[model samples]
Target: MIKFDGIAAFVATAEAGSISAASRRLGLAKSVVSERLAELERILGTKLIQRTTRKLSLTENGQTFLPRAQRILREADEAAAELAARSGKLAGPLRLSAPVSFGILHLAPALTKFIQEHPQIEVSVELDDRFVDAAAGGFDAVLRHGAIGDSRLIARRLATSRRLLVASPAYLEREGHPASIDELQHHCGILYSMREGDWRFSTEHGWQVVRPKAALRANNGLVMREAAMAGLGITLLPTFFIHEAVKSGVLVPIDVGARAEGAELFITYPRDHGASAKIRALADSLQRSFGNPPYWDRLAS
Candidate 1:
C-alpha cells in the first residue's frame, strides 16, 4: 500500500526543489521529509531525486511522476473538502486578490459580514490595482473588473459597474458643461492614467472618441475623484466611486446624450481544481451582498 504522506512529501520536495524548502512549506522537519522521500523511493524501487550538497534535481522517473502525484493530492483535497461541505462545516484558508478602490470601499464591508457568518473560514485578501496571476500568486480567487483575459480561469460575473461623466457642481457652473462629445476636447479633463487618454461614448451615429487635454492625471481613482471634487475638471469614473458624491450633490452628471459601456466585475478562479466550499461560500456571500443592481447603485438611486 502507498503511504499518502510519502507521496505528499515527494511532491512537496520536488516542487520546492529542496527538502529544507519543502519542510518549511509543509511545516515538517527536514529529517521527517527525508524519511518520507526515502520510504516513497523504497516503495517504488526507484530513486526519484538526485541530491547533492549544492543542488537538488529530479530524476527522469520523478519528472514523469510529478504531475500524477500533484493530481492525486488535488483529488484527495477535493474529496475532503466535499465531505466537509456536505456536513456544512466548511473550514479552510481562502486567499483572495481584489482591486484597491473596490476592496476598500465595497469588499471590506462584505467581508466583515462573510467572516461573521463563516467563523471557521480564514480569509486573506490582497488589495492591488495591478493584474495578478491568481494561480501563480496562490490566491483562491480574484475579483477583477472588465473582461477575463486568461481562458484557463473560470469567471463568474458578480455585477456590472456603471460609469458616468461627472464634474463638481462648482466646476460645471464655472466652466460650463460641454453640450457634445466634440466640445469635450475644449474642456480640461482629470484622467485615470491606467486607461486610455481618449474617452469613448456611444452616439447616435456610432462610438465617439475624444481625447481631452488633461489638467491632472492620476493613477489612483480616489485622488482623481478628489481633484474633480475640488473643481479641477470633468472626469469619467465608476458609479461605485462617485455614487455618494452624486447623491450628495457634490458631483453632477453631465448629459452629453451619450452613455459609456459598463464594465463587468468578475470573480475568477483557476479551472484546474474546482472551487472549494469556502470559495463557493464567499462567492455566494458577495453575490448576495452586491445584489442585481448592486447595493451601491441602489443607494445612490
Candidate 2:
C-alpha cells in the first residue's frame, strides 16, 4: 500500500528543493523526511529523485508522479473540507496572497473582520505585487487585480477595478489637458517602471496605443499616485484606492476621447482546491465586504 506520509515527504522535498527545507516546512526532522522518502522509493521499487551535493533533481518517473501526488493531496483535503462544511464551522489553516496596495487598503480590513468571525481559523497572508502561483505557493486562495491568466486557477469576482488616466489639477493646468486620445501621446506621463506594455485606450474604432513622454517612473502604485498628486504627470491608477483623491479633487480623471481599460478585483485559487470550504468562506466574505459598487467607487467618476 502507498503510505501517504511517504508521498507527502516526497512532494515536500521536491517542492522545497531540499530535505532540510522540506523538514522546516513540514515541521519534521530532516532524518525523518529522508527516511520517508527512502521508504517511498523502496515501495515503488524505483528511484524517484536523484541526489547531489550541489543540487537535487527529480528523476523522470518522479517528474511524472509529482502532479499525481499533488492531486492526491488536494483530493484528500477536499474530502476533509467537505466534512467540515456540513458543520458550517471554519477552522483550518488558510494561506493566501494579495497585491500589496490592495492588501493594505482593503484586504487587511476584510481579513480582520473575517478572522474575528472565525476565530478558530488560522490565516496566513503574503502581500506582494509580484505574481504568485496558488499551486506552487500552496495558497488556499489569492486576491488579485486585473484578469486571471492562469487556466489552472478558478477566479471569483469580488468587485470592479476601474483604471483611469488621472493627473493633478496643477499639472493639467500647466501642461494643458489632451483634447483626444491621439493628443495624449504628446503629454508627459508618470509611468510605472515595470509596466508591461504601452498605454491602451478603448476608442470608438477599437483599442488604441498611446505612449506619452515620461516625466517620472515608479514601481509602486502609491509612489506613482503621490507623484501625480504633486503635479508630476498623468498616470493610470485603479479607482478602488484612488477614489478618495479623485473625490476630493486632488486628482482629476481624464476622458479625452477614450476610456482606459480597467481590471476586476478577484480571488483565485488552484483548480484542485475548487471544492475547499476555506476558499469559499474567504471569497464570500470579500465579496460581501466590497459590495456591488464597492464603497471606494461611490463618488469616483
Candidate 3:
C-alpha cells in the first residue's frame, strides 16, 4: 500500500524542484522528506527521480505518476478541509509570496493581525520582486499588481490605485514642470527599470505615450520614489507608494491635463488549491483591511 505521506512528499519535492524547498513547504526535516521519497520509490520497485548536485529531475516513471499523485493529494486535502470546517477550526501551514515593497509597507501589518486571530495557522511569507510559480513554489497564495499571466491561477482584485506623474518641489522649481505630454522629453526621468520608460495618458484627443529620458533607473519602487524625493527627476509611480509624500508636501503631482491609468492589485492562488481554510481566512482579512477605496488613497484624498 502506498502511504499518503510518501505520496505527498514525492509530489511536493517534484513541484518545488528540490528536497530542501519541499521540506520547507511541508515544515518537515530534510532527512524526513528524503526518507519518505526513498521509501515511496522502494515500495513501487522503481527509481523515480534523478538527483544531481545542481538539480533534481523526475524519471519517466515519476513524470507519469505525478498527475495521479497530485489528484490523490488534492482529494485528500479537500476531505480534510470538510472535516475541519465542520468543527469550525483551521490548522495548517500557509506559504505566501509577495513583492518586496508592498509586502513590507502593507502586508506585514495585515499578516500580524491574521496570525493573532488564527493562532493555529503557521504562516510563512517570502518577499521578492521576481515572479514565482505559486503551485510549483508551494505557495498557498501570492500578491500581485496588474494582470496575472498564469492561466492556472485565480486572481481576486483587492483594490485599484492610479499611477501619477510626480516630482520634488525643488526639482520642479529649478527645472520647471512640463506644460504638456510632448514637452516631457526635455526633462530628466526617474524610471522603474523593469518597465519601459513609456508614460501613457488619456487625453481628450485620445491616448498618448511619452518615452522619457531616464536619468536614474531602478528595479525597486522604493528606490525610484526615494530618488524622485531627493530632487533627482520626475517619475510616474503608483499612488499607494507616494500618496503620503504627496500629502506631506514632499512630492507634488504634475497634471498636464492627462488622466493617468489605474492598476489593479490582486491576491492570486493556484486553482487546484481548492478552498484552503487558511488561504480563505487570510484573503478575507486582507480584503477587509484594504477596504473598497483603499486606506492609502483615502489618506491621499
Candidate 4:
C-alpha cells in the first residue's frame, strides 16, 4: 500500500521545485522531506525528480502523477472544508509570500499583530523579491508591489506607493544637485538592477524617461537604500522604503514636484480555491493595516 504522506510530500517537492522550498512551505524538516521523497520513489520503483544543484525538475513519472496528486488533495480539502463549515469554524495553516524588503519593512510588523488577533491560525511567511508561483509554491496569499499581471489570481489592491527621486544631502553637496529635470542627465544615478534603465517619470513636460549612468547598482531595496544613505547617487525608489529616511533628513527628495511611475501594492492569491476564510482574513488585515493610503503616498516630494 502506498503511503499518502509520502505521495503528498512528493507532490509538494515537484511543485516547489526543491526539497528545501517544499520543506519550508510544508513546515517539515529538510531530512524529513528527503526521507519522504525517497520512500515515495522506492514504493513506486521510479525516480520522481531530477535533483540538480540549481533546481529540482520533475521527472516524467513525477509530471504524470502531479495533477493526480493535486486533484486528490483538492478533493480532500473540499471535503474537509464542507465538514468544517458545518461547525462554523476556521482552522488551517495559512501560507503567505511577500517581497523581502516589503515584508521586512511592512508585512512582518503587521503579521505580528495578525497573529495576536487570530490565535487559532498558524501562519508561515516566505520573503523573496522574485516573482512567486503561488499555487505551485503552495502559498495561500502573496503581497506584491507593481502592476498586477492579468492572471487567474485574485488581486486586492492594498495601497499605492509613489515613486520619488531622492539622494543623501551629502551626495547633493558633493555631486551638486540637478536644478531641473533636464539637468538630471548630468547627475549620477543609483540604479536598481531589477528595474535597470526603464525609468519613467512625470515632469513639467509631462512623462519622461531617462537612462542615466549608475555609480552603483544593486538588486535589493535595502542595499539600494544603504547606498543612497552613504551618499552614492540619486535613486528612484518607492516612497515606502525612503519616506522615513527623507523625513528624518537622512535623504532628501531631488526633483521636489516631479512624479514617476508608481506601483500598486496588492494582496494576491490563487483564484482556483475561490476566496477562503484564511485568504479573506489576511487580505482584510492587510487592507486595514496599510490600506488607509500608506504613509508613503503622503511623503513630501
Q: Flag the better candidate by TM-score, 1 or 3.
A: 3
Clashing pairs for predicted structure model 1, backbone only: none
28, model 4: CA deviation in Å? 6.2
lDDT of each: 0.84, 0.84, 0.84, 0.78
Worst 10 residues of 3 by lDDT: 74-83
- Tens-digit lDDT track of model 1 for 1-301: 7799999899888866799988986789999999999999999999999999999999999988876887687667667767878888776667789999899998999999999888877787989999888654556689998889897799988888778888998899899989888888999999988878447788888877777989999877788889999999999888888999989999898878788766678899878877777778888999888888887677556
| Local accuracy of candidate 2 as per-residue lDDT tens digits, 1-301 | 7899999899889877999998987889999999999999999998999999999999999999888987787677667767777887767677789988889988899999899877867887889898888766766788877778898888888898678889999999999988898788888888877765547878878888777888987767888899999998998888876898999999998888777887688888887558488778878888888877777777686
Cand. 2 Cα-lDDT? 0.84
Model 2 stretches astray by more than 4 angstroms = 135-137, 193-198, 217-219, 299-301
Cα error, residue 154 of model 2, in Å, equals 2.5
TM-score of 3: 0.90
Query: Which scores better on TM-score, 1 or 2?
Result: 2
All candidates: TM-score: 0.78, 0.86, 0.90, 0.82
Better of 2 and 4 by lDDT: 2
Give the root-mean-square deviation of each candidate in angstroms: 4.4, 2.7, 2.2, 3.6
* Clashes in predicted model 4: 0
